[model samples]
Target: MIEVKDVWKKYKIYQDKPVSFKERFLYKRKGVFQEKWVLQGISLSIEKGKMIGLIGRNGSGKSTLLKMMTKILQPDKGELKIIGRVSSLLELGAGFHMDFTGRENIFMNASLFGLSRKEINSKLQEIIRFAELDTFIDNPVRTYSSGMFMRLAFSIAIHVEPDILLIDEILAVGDNAFQKKCISKIEEFKEKGKTIVFVSHDNGIMERLCDELYWIHESKLVKKGKPEEVIRDYLDFLSGSEEQRLKNEVMQQENQQTSQIEVTEQNEEVNKKENKRWGNGAVEITNIAIRNPDNENKFIFTREQRLEVELTYKTTNLKVERPVFGVGIFKMDGTNCYGTNTYIDKVELEISEHGKVRYCIESLNLVQGDYYVDVACHHEDGTPYDYITKAANFSVHSKENDQGIAFLPHKWFFEKGGES
Candidate 1:
């Protein structure tokens, strides 16, 4: 259990950091400083055995809050009471001594979690095996790569079996296989009713793993609720912010080149209905449609039903060569289902004026859910000419209910053997 009461944290920002004692003494009175509040009167109570997620943009104080929970940093004004032992994977090589051998640091870090030498010895081999660091165990940790260091730190932290676990996006460090292993280990911890506080930008992981989600913005708690609801709101907020930024950029460009170029006015109603759109303006997507196999535009489909996406656009440049068209499907809760581009599929287009591109999905295997589509036109090298997020919305209907987003074809068979 964790209880935070009216927590407030602030840091002093200095124009220049003093490097020497004389400089510090001289600048002590002359230095210009500004105080910025990273967290403002935050109050929350987390029940034991709950998996909580912290979601926010960068510099929103998510990591700062995690550090306070781990007792690495203290809030300037507040009370925090944590009832159980805690283990954190806050940063790569955070608790490591660079000069110490990997084997030695493992023991040292485990001891910080209150593990005795005997207990550490029993778990040492397992930790090494999990980190896949048998050969580098005796080598100085300073010689280890970022991935190797993360492996060792994560292995020790998870194996310690603390009552509470705090993770701050450090899982993004390793290779895919190791990341999977770490996720499995975290799931195991969750099954054992361990309290977990995770901060990650991976929406799918948060939606799948978290029992509750917290949205932080501008060093304040914006919302806290179910993962689906909170993540949807957070995504809308991001989309709105992106659209405003694009609008500002377009206005600035128009002001600078009013006579040289003509800009098409976008319909307000269409912009509101469609997903957020932005690009370099070399080409613009004029229309998008989600149609069924009959070529009729629709926003609903069923599992294994043929679906098609039609994209219409006009190029402002004289000629655009090898224009790659892309489409993506995402779950309503911000999980990316699938994405592909013309380049990847070996299709290319050259457009100097108006053109239409169609992408047909032979069979939609997605389960019953609301899904959104994204369309984009870009170069083969990934430079976007026009990009749209959630350009269209549709729903998939399925007679059979399934737990996950996708349904795969499979059959179950059993075998019986008689005594020989």
Candidate 2:
């Protein structure tokens, strides 16, 4: 469990190089520097046994907040209260000594995490096996590759058996198989009710493992909610440059006199009347609608029912030819169920003049669950013309006797004597 209230961290950036030693000796002062608040007034509370994800663009203060929670760095203002022992993998070989052998660094990191000699001795063989460092464990850690060092570091950190685990992007260093092993170990800890604070750019993994998510932007906590909503927002942010978004937000804040917000109680009611674009692009998609054979837009459906997607788009370019339309269905973990492009099918369409194009997909076989649709338009040679990563997202509800991400509508019969 962790609680942060009104937390702020300020860092000093040197503005200019200090003068020569003679000037400094005479001036008796340090170089000129300006303070930049990396994190400002960030507050959040985490419940025990909950896995939380911290997400944002680079320099958005995610790592700063993690360090504050782990007590590696103290906040300039506010209080941070963390319950239970915390094991952190903030960086590769965080507490390791380059001069020390791998075995020595293991003992050092273990002791730093409060593991006794007897306890580390008990798990040493298992740790070695997990790290797969066999004979190389005796070599100096400076000689190890980045991946090997990360593997050993993670192996020791997790073996500490802390109540709280703090992880940054260190998982990126491990190979896929080792990362899988690490995820399984994290799942094991989650089953036992340990707290985890994970920070990553991999939205797929975050959505799969995080119980909740926090989105940090412009030195502040912007949104905290269910993994799906938070991840969606984060993805939208990714579609744009962070610097431009921050600048726009600041300008809007400064000129708040003309800004307006329309509030409505029911989301469905609001969506029925309002058209909201998710991002900026060369082509804009509008009028997205899907329906069944009965033309009903709402309610649950049988797995064997038909599905459709229709949308209209306006192009910004005049000279566009062989414009290919792409559609992708993605799972919650950002995994693609299937994706297709009109270009792949060699459907040639010439758009000599910029105008509107209407696209439709009929009788799509979708299983029972929530799924998102990413639509894009591109040239035949794979150059992006215009597109929305997620044009429309919809949910599929089950009536009964439905399974998997889609319903196959199949009938099976077994013969007793090897006859069909």
Clashes of each: 0, 2
In the range 176-290, model 1's lDDT, one tens digit per residue, is: 9999998898899999999999999988889889999989899999999999899878876765675466456655855775342333454433554564766676888877778
Give stretches of model 2 more than 4 Å off. Answer: 17-30, 240-420
Candidate 1, number of clashes? 0
lDDT of each: 0.87, 0.76
Q: Residue-wise lDDT of candidate 2 within 103-164, one digit each (tens)?
A: 88888889988889999999888889989999899999999999998899889878889999
Kindly report which residue pairs in candidate 2 clash with one another. 367-405, 367-406
TM-score: model 2 vs. ground truth? 0.60
Give the top-scoring candidate (lDDT): 1
> Whose TM-score is greatest here?
1
Q: Give the TM-score of candidate 1.
A: 0.66
